[model samples]
Target: METTPFFIFLFIHLSCLVLGFGSVMVTDLYGLMWIRDRVRFTQVISVSGVTEKFIWAGWIGMVAAGIPLIILKGEIDNLMTIKLFFVALIAINGIILHFLHKKVGKYKKGEHVPNLFMFRLMLSLFVSQLSWWGALLIGFLHRHVTTIINWPDMPWLVSGLILGAFLMIWGLGEIYFKVKEV
Candidate 1:
């Protein structure tokens, strides 16, 4: 059988997803390590800037490649619709986090730290988890929704829900810790 355009699109889509995810993971890991070690403000700022740049570039690359791929694949169905929603959510959260990081880096000793920045960061992380869960759900539903309806056997949905819950708890913990410090 001849190869379908859908397969081509799928390949490109998956490639971009992998690359984008890897970029984010590397950035987050680096940030976590830097923060844990109590790095200098200038070092932190530089690291954040570099990581943020990678994230933006990866995101833009994904978008630039994904739109045409989706178009070529055909009309958006339920799964694609859901996936798009999560993708949009991820983009919004990323933009918010980018600004929040800038604000956080601006704080100096004796300067009153704004809770709004922390709030925004917390929300962004929460939304990031939501996006991941949504993506997982859409992926799972895409495979078996036409035949299966049970919740337990649905790995994607279950994983997504679990991840979402974890994200909420993580965000709450961060808020609690910050409040204690204040």
Candidate 2:
């Protein structure tokens, strides 16, 4: 791999990570602010609406740059596989979050948000944090301490267990909200 191309791809990859993850972090902070009554739901939605573009741009660019980096480096191990799985989960979760954002946007000021919506939003936030941070951690480990860390043998099983736990949490949330309403 040429040094110039490798550096270029790495730069784009890092830039995308910062842009996307930074936007997501800001949006989550605003959501927490709303939950804490430090800000309004409308304000949180506004910030999310604005930052969504950057989030998507960062995700897309990161993925685009990642393929070349993988090829250039020619290092694919169990950890890399796990990271890729996490990236795919992020994409899937992003789509679900986008729709949830749309649903949240429909409420007028002062209207009570539904319990289900709140629960789902919380679930999405949890999943987002898990996927994003998990991917970041896996990438860092693979890049920095490849020889030290012992990655799991079955990457699919690991991915499945992580996603399954998230889904279970979401299902439990749904049940809790339903029971509360009853």
Candidate 3:
């Protein structure tokens, strides 16, 4: 709200979120489409590879700026802790997915997409979507969604959101595979 230094950092943090998670939507969407057309697999890998750089850059920027944003809030509360937890998830998931990129690279270069690969990819997608979207939602609601739900109810709402989104994404991945086989 303020044009002070903290708010400036906050704006940077939001920009990082846009850069990182926005790229993820593209990667995830193309990855899903790749099931129907092998050529799309290349797009998934290409786009993801290129975007992953910015995603990581944004992640780092968010972290560097986010700590101050939290400190400026001036109270170490539950909501802050919960948000940090999700941020950690996003970071850890990014680390794991960094390695997983090699598998995707191989797939793009004509390596076989085995069942295990698909399973892992689905899981990675879950973590990526869940962490990025989940953290962003929690962050938003923490800041601006108070009109609908009070802060006291946030933990339960976040829990339900995380679990529900994970299940739905997993189910969709399963359905995609099943339908692809048909």
Q: Which candidate wins on lDDT?
A: 2
TM-score head-to-head 1 vs 3, winner: 3
Question: Mind giving the per-residue lDDT tens digits that candidate 3 earns over 54-149?
Answer: 888888888988888767765645565556667777777778787888766775466677665577677977777867776787778867754133
Per-residue lDDT tens digits of candidate 2, residues 6-113? 889989999999999999999999998888999988899999999989999999999999999888887777777888888888888889999999998999999988
Per-prediction TM-score, please? 0.61, 0.93, 0.74
lDDT of 1 by residue, 83-130 (tens): 766777688778877878877777885476656555556567667766
Per-candidate Cα lDDT values, in order, are 0.64, 0.87, 0.73
Regions of candidate 1 where Cα sits further than 4 Å from its true position? 1-5, 34-44, 109-116, 136-182
By descending TM-score, how would the candidates be arranged? 2, 3, 1
**Model 1 quality (TM-score):** 0.61
- Model 1 C-alpha RMSD vs. true structure (Å) is 5.9
Model 3 TM-score, all chains together: 0.74
Worst 10 residues of 1 by lDDT: 146-155
